[model samples]
Target: MQPGTFELLILIFIFLGLQAWWIIPIINKNNKFNKRGKDLREEIKQLEKLYKK
Candidate 1:
């Protein structure tokens, strides 16, 4: 395989992995709120749970 092609593939994978790392948790938090509603205390508790873990 060509070195340039391999490097391009690695770059693409890194970009996608970084995007998921940043976006997935926000999506999950939003989903949690969708299930729990606009409860500030609940969100705070959730954040605490994650921090403890």
Candidate 2:
């Protein structure tokens, strides 16, 4: 059986929403890690400076 226009629209919306829901958290997690990475690098640099001094 062929789907009607309304049914197709609903399916597309659902698929897009589900994709966003799954993808958004991963994007946010990567953003958090990226922010932390800078801090970690700074701390490592400080440690190296202390060791060299």
Candidate 3:
């Protein structure tokens, strides 16, 4: 209800929004790499299974 507190809340939201804008793309890129890593691990496991058999 206080004007100063409201302004502070708005500033915090703006800061967090900006941070998310910058961070989300990096997180998405990392996710892509993580998915690729998982796929590679699966392939490796399959290869090992084939070799054992």
Best of the candidates, TM-score:
2
- Stretches of candidate 1 off by over 4 Å are 1-3, 38-53
TM-score of each: 0.64, 0.80, 0.71
- Write down the lDDT that model 2 would get: 0.96
Off by over 4 Å in 3: 51-53
Candidate 1 structure quality by residue, lDDT tens digits, 18-50: 999999999999999887775777899899999
Q: Candidate 2 on 1-53: residue-level lDDT in tens? A: 56598899899999999999999999999999999999999999999999999
- TM-score quality measure for candidate 3: 0.71
Q: Rank the candidates by lDDT, best first.
A: 3, 2, 1
How accurate locally, in lDDT, is each candidate?
Answer: 0.91, 0.96, 0.98
RMSD of each: 11.3, 2.8, 1.8
Candidate 2 lDDT trough over 10 residues, lowest sum: 1-10
Task: State how far residue 38 of model 1 sits from its true place (Å).
Answer: 8.9
Q: What are the runs in model 2 whose C-alpha is more than 4 Å off?
A: 1-3
Looking at model 1, report the run of 10 residues with the lowest lDDT sum.
33-42
Residue 35 local lDDT, model 3: 100
